[model samples]
Target: MKPATAAKKLGIYLPAAPQDFQDSEVTRAEFNQLQQNPPEWLAELRRNGPHPRPVVAQKLGISISGLARGGVTEPLTTADITTLLAEPPKWLVAERSTHAAVRKQDLIAKKLHSESPKN
Candidate 1:
């Protein structure tokens, strides 16, 4: 699979991946192996992403604008994310409701789309 696809499956940011990983294709077996038993590098990347804004926002259960409002201007490691979850600040608590609403809307939209008549 393509590196980006592999990265998504592993829940790691592609840009944060090592040069070798970026330059190579991940075979199906390798993908399975990574899923079954991640290497140190893969584990590290998943835990500490130089993730893009969208990924970070999604992980934090906030919109990009919310992140900006909260003064978050950088990629976060899994540890950082965990810390926030463990001791959620006011901004995060507020954004969690927004995120839940957004997810609910997305589910509603998906259900509607699937129920629509086929072309």
Candidate 2:
């Protein structure tokens, strides 16, 4: 599979992966092995990685746009994400509230849509 696809499956950030991993292609066997029984390196990467934006947002409990607004342009390691969550800044706090509001609105909208008559 492609590097990006592999990284996504592994829940890792491609740019932060090792050089060899970045350069090589992941065969089906390798992918399956990684899923079934990841090696030490793979385990380490998943545990403390430069996680992708979606994962980062999920970990931070904010939207991806929130990360952008908070000026987090680069991928963050698990440690960095942990620290941010542990000590949320003003922007993060504000964004989390905004995100929560947006999610609530979305839920309301979905309910309204479901209740509406079919056209």
Candidate No. with top TM-score: 2
Give me candidate 1's TM-score against the actual structure: 0.62
Candidate 2 deviant stretches above 4 angstroms: none
With a 3 Å backbone cut-off (N, CA, C), the pairs that clash in candidate 2 are none
Q: Which stretches of candidate 1 lie over 4 Å from their true place?
A: 50-59, 63-73, 86-90, 102-119
**What are the per-model numbers of colliding residue pairs?**
0, 0
Error at 89, model 1, angstroms: 4.9
| lDDT: worst 10-residue window of model 2 | 12-21
In the range 12-81, model 1's lDDT, one tens digit per residue, is 7777888999999999999999999999988777667666567778888889888888888877777788
